[model samples]
Target: MGAGHAHKLYRPAHSPVHALPPHCKIAAVLCFVLAVVATPRTALWAFALYALLLAAVAAAARVPAGFLLKRLLIEVPFVAFAVLMPFVATGPRVHILGLSLSESGLWGAWNILAKGTLGVAASVLLAATTELRGLLLGLQRLRMPPLLVQIASFMIRYGDVIADELRRMRIARLSRGFEARGVRHWGVLAKSAGALFIRSYERGERVHLAMVSRGYTGTLPVPDAAPATGGQWSRAAALPAAALAVCLLGWTL
Candidate 1:
């Protein structure tokens, strides 16, 4: 995939959505998610509205349908967890379509699925509209622990390099007769993992040295000013606001 489609990762573009400041989007989207998650799952209309709100945000951000689908898929683990909860959690069980499911547990499961899906969508929009670096800056602005932001900044900086290296290693293994299918094969796989780790460690050292040579400071610094304006907050807020409103309406109905 081209960089644009690669992981639906963030980069600055000329799009209107891309012009918004990162912190505002993060705050608004997070609040929206909390609202959805806090709502009762039996409120089915609320969940539907939450899904629709996510779709609307995608459209407003000009996100391609394919990109949104990929983002949605990333929530599969959460959805799975939610789906399993009803069966695994102890509660009053009822039969649905010839399957036993918990009453309260089922509600809890749906709640998790809705919240997780919405959360993932919100994250995708944040990444789509803002550069990865910009998001880190916004994190710092939002007073996220400095140490955490510093670590995240470095990880984002070198994440692609590490990923590329992994791809090359995989390709090398594939070119050889390494079929990843048996116990014996796993030994070689383990060795390869060790080798990959060593390489990554050496790369990190080299990167640190290079940065130091180039006048590296104690902390990663960013531009104090981002172009996101107050207007952008309003535009982004509209989504979560509507979502929350729908949930309230569901409760009322």
Candidate 2:
């Protein structure tokens, strides 16, 4: 990925969290999330502990609470789905304020809400500290399929170009007094989308050809770098270690 394609989620900083290797951070986040997922949903204290752990990490990373909260809104759709569970789910109904709700559904909703929120928060924190290219590199280092990593890399690199193309097309439409005010304009919108797809495809072909001409191989070249030191691994492992402790407590308690 091009260095110019820095994702909006990354915040440039000199903190220790930011200094850690990308693969280590990726592994840490994955382990942390797995621990959270393994925890029993009914363990309310466990969830609170998880939140506090994340909060500590956020503070250590110097990520703003407002920034985290704003990005956390990405989970709103899942929250909406979970909200309906209590009302729509059947079996073992409980009366609450003259309305009956399924107890199982209530538990299901809590599960979704608690687990989903924690997962998203962890992801947001990861993104906030790591750049898009770093994430792709991390995946590549972690033995992820090269094809998938390349696809993600290209998507991140060219996503802005595609968005800019869309913006220009919209402007051209507006210039021609083509307002998409109703279903009548659907045909125009569909045609525009089709054209965009064709253009993107053609661009991809050209890029591929250029790479082939430049002696491109099936896999990207890995940079020669020092392996992670024992200290670095321990530091990176700390977050997941704490999370695992919480998971064990949740299970045993």
Candidate 3:
């Protein structure tokens, strides 16, 4: 994992949440989300409790409410899809405010909104507290496939480079008074995209060759570190344990 690959989502902090091993946090978030998804949507109160649990994690992590809420905007497309379910889905209808909505669709929409939002919130909190490099390292520690880790590492490392290239291309276009106002400009935009892809592919090839020349192998070297302590594991398990309790209640009650 490269130190140059810090993402905007990570907020630098000295809190205990930030101090915990990256792998522990990753596992905790994963389990927490699983528990959330397994929860019964009919248990509305359980969803509220789940939100509170995440809120507690955010407070421990020193992540602001605004930060979490803003990143949640990424799920707008999912929300839109969920919203349409009630209108388009066929099932028993319930009238609310002069419109007939499927009862099953309402439940489906609620399920998606609740589970999806909680999952996204959990992920946002993880990303907020963990750097991209740390996340790749954590995945490696968790025994994720080396090839997948390498792909993610390279993507994180070069995503900015690709974006910068696109920016420069846009600047060149703007300098030449190329404005994308209508379908006529789509050709130029498509051509620009194609050129960018070729440049990126060529760059990847050069990077690969350079690595091979320098004793590159299928696996990247991992820095040795002590495994998470029992105490740390217990602490990290707290979130998921609480969520599991709630999920059980959701199913039973």
Candidate 4:
């Protein structure tokens, strides 16, 4: 993806977390999330410790609490699903506020809420620290399938172009007195979508031809790797290492 395609989630900073190599950050986040997932749902205090660990990392990264909380709204749908679990789950029930709720459902809800929140929080933090291109490079370093990486690269590169194309189509429709009032307008919208797909496909073909003319190979050129030093790896590993410790305590205690 072009440097211009940097994601909005990346918060430019000189903090330790931001300075960590992208691959290290990726590995650390993966390990931390695995640790969180391995924790027992009944270990309520352990969840608190995990939250604190994330908070500490956030502080070190200079990520704002408000920013993180605002992004956490992305999980609202999951939260809603968890909320309904207590009502629909079948098993022994308990009374709360004079309403019967499944006891097991409550545990399930807590499990979802706790783990999902932590996982989302970790992801948001990762995005905040790493640029989209850096993330792709990280995945490449981690030996992610080149095809998947290239696909993601193209998606990031062209996503804005596609959205801009849609906006222009919308404007053209509006100029032509199309208001999209009801089912009557669906046909027009469908035709516009078909046109957009055709345009995108043609553009892809042109790009591929241009690449072929330039002697493009099946694999993209790999950039020079600046693998992280041992010290940097140690620093990066600290985050997941701390999380693992907490996970062990959660399981044992």
What TM-score does candidate 4 get on C-alpha atoms?
0.95
Ten-residue region with minimum lDDT total, candidate 4: 1-10
Per-residue lDDT of candidate 1, residues 1-253 (tens digit)? 2353233375345766666677887888788878887777678877877777777777767887787678689777777788888898787899999999888888888777777777787777777887766677788888898789988877866677787887888889999867688887888788778988999899888988998999987676666685556688788788778877887887777
lDDT, candidate 3, 92-198, per-residue tens:
99999999999999999999999999999999999999878789989999999979999998998899999999999999999999989999889999999999999
The stretch of ten residues in a row with the least summed lDDT in candidate 3 is: 1-10
Q: Which stretches of candidate 4 lie over 4 Å from their true place?
A: 1-3
Q: lDDT tens string, model 2, 103-178?
A: 9999999999999999999999999999787888888889999899999988988899999999999999999988
Clashing pairs in 1: none
Q: Residue 37's C-alpha lDDT in candidate 2?
A: 94
Clashing pairs in 4: none
lDDT of 4 by residue, 99-193 (tens): 99999999999999999999999999999999888899999999999989998988888888888999999999999888898998899999999
Segments in model 1 whose C-alpha atoms lie over 4 Å from true places: 1-7, 10-14, 84-95, 98-100, 173-176, 226-228, 247-253
TM-score of 2: 0.95
Give the candidate order by descending TM-score. 4, 3, 2, 1
Score every model by TM-score: 0.81, 0.95, 0.95, 0.95
- What's the CA error at residue 214 for candidate 3, in Å? 2.7
